[model samples]
Target: MLKVLNAGNETLYNNVSFNIKGQEIYANSLILICAAPYFEEIFVESSTNFNQTYNDIEPDSFRVFLRWLYGESLSQAMQNYEKEENRDIFFQICKDLLLASSKFNISTIKELIEYKLVTYIHDDLVYDNLEKVIELANEYELDDLFKYCEGLKDVIKDEADEPENSNIRVTKNNSRPSIINNLKLRFFKFRFFLKTRTEPGHKFKVIN
Candidate 1:
């Protein structure tokens, strides 16, 4: 009852349609209608790393495969679903699809991954995913991916140092004047004077 489209050999289920132009599996309205539930299950299961698994597929072929997998267009596939469950499921699918595309050495997929990383820079969960993305980009020799990851290192480092309750301020007491205390005071005064005299707007003013 379910019609299966095969990219390899350009064939359809029951061998009803055959062509040499290329194997593009087009799901009919009836097939999409009947296959929604099954497709949903497959999408969920394969949503994690499906793209990496099919990395050997050529770009054109993979695009065709994607078209067959999602009855909608690429733009539609990128839309955020309303339902929480659907949104989560779709993102998982997109992640898997990107991984698969990377595996296939697809430049477009690499760019997409970079875009996603830049877009989600503020996400706490992005670091782990970005690590993997960096590894993939390195392995594939994707220059843009490498640059994006390199830039992300600074962002991640800043985040790591930004703790709410970790500030430490030391106070000095003038009650006891030791050599160290005198030196510290002199250094503080020198720094303050330097800051005051180094203003760009008053560069021509002489410091007394």
Candidate 2:
């Protein structure tokens, strides 16, 4: 059986602290090292500081990753976000988690996120979200998912080229844009994440 840790509610044996964008999150070093072995280097016995800071990652996304680290089902966490009726937040979290997983060498989470994202795109071909996914897939070298998104792009092109669908209604979120006749699709700005560890005693820090 998995021993699940209640994130902020846990008091016992929570030795490491992650200060992300002024928010303090506590976790067990053992759990983190077990999930991602490279963390073992960051949480060394010689290191006096137990706090890690990250400006690049969102607190919500870090919490989602921690939940999975502490044995919560990823699907359940995603479902909770989906029930909130704000799918943008849900997808954003997935995107962030995918990046974090890749950085931490957590292949399981990375693969799961890729599958989830592609599945979501398949279900709903939202224009903006699809474009973002395409960028991530291409940048991250996710060849298969990138190819799938390219196919979706062709579908979008076909729909956009249709004169009858030129006046599709635009929503408040602008998720569905006007047909390709007048719509100009632009790629999202690229973001870079950097992690630095200058010395042995210094804790790891992520800078955007």
Candidate 3:
């Protein structure tokens, strides 16, 4: 697959361009169809001759996922995502990646991301972040994390719970800002460079 991507011969015929937030990605329909049923549907359903593109997707997220589809490691795809400045949107980006993975039937990537989400939530367990955790738990249907949150909720219920110990038993999330809530327009932008090489028939061939 990487050979064809590098050689660019196989990508020439019947390719589609995905328009993501003004950035374009040209991919082979057959390969994408074999990998993801959703892509098959997208190609089969298109009624135009200009090729199909999904404008709703985030370009950076798609680029990371597209790199993974070609042979890059998920960890590499997530490396920039783990930066301190991007931490607040990490889970949100993960969630977006998860959605894309699910759409593309990328099980390995999906499972790894799900595990990361669980670990992040676990590490963030506390009263000040309970509601944020709970909201994400519910959004992702994270049963174990929700149970942990419930246990902490019970601590606040019991009058015997110490007021001095706000460690894990911190107050509800309403008192503090949520990471998701604080995510602004800039946080959603996962900027990355896309290498391009011009090919025949006006096709935008991917080089890296």
Model 3 TM: 0.57
Q: Please, what is the whole-model Cα lDDT of each candidate in the order they appear?
A: 0.40, 0.63, 0.53
Candidate 1 runs further than 4 Å off: 1-65, 68-73, 80-106, 120-122, 162-208
Q: Which digits, one per residue and each the tens of the lDDT, describe model 1 over residues 1-208?
A: 2224434324343222222134433333334223234333343555542222323333443443344233433333354532334544434444555655554333344444344333332232245655765775576666754665666555445544657313312123223234225334444454354345333221111112
Error of 3 at 57 (Å): 3.5
Cα error, residue 15 of model 3, in Å, equals 2.5
lDDT, model 3, position 105: 56
Q: Residues 89-188, candidate 3, lDDT per residue (tens digit)?
A: 7766676776676566554554455445544544444555557657766775656445655754564455235464344222214333432232211122
Query: In model 2, what is the error at residue 193, expressed in angstroms?
Result: 29
List where candidate 3 sits over 4 angstroms from the true fold: 1-14, 44-50, 53-56, 101-109, 122-130, 142-145, 148-161, 167-208
Sorted by lDDT (best first), the order is 2, 3, 1
Candidate 2 is scored at a TM of: 0.72
Q: Residue by residue across 1-208, what tens digits does model 2's lDDT show?
A: 1233454526667788889789998888877776667687788754766788988888888887877766666765566676437677878788788878777766556555666666556445567778888888877777766766676677667775788666433333345444322232311110010012112121223312
Clashes of each: 4, 0, 1
The runs of at least 3 residues in candidate 2 whose Cα sits more than 4 Å from the true structure, single-residue gaps closed, are 1-4, 7-10, 167-208
Give the lDDT of residue 10 in candidate 3: 44
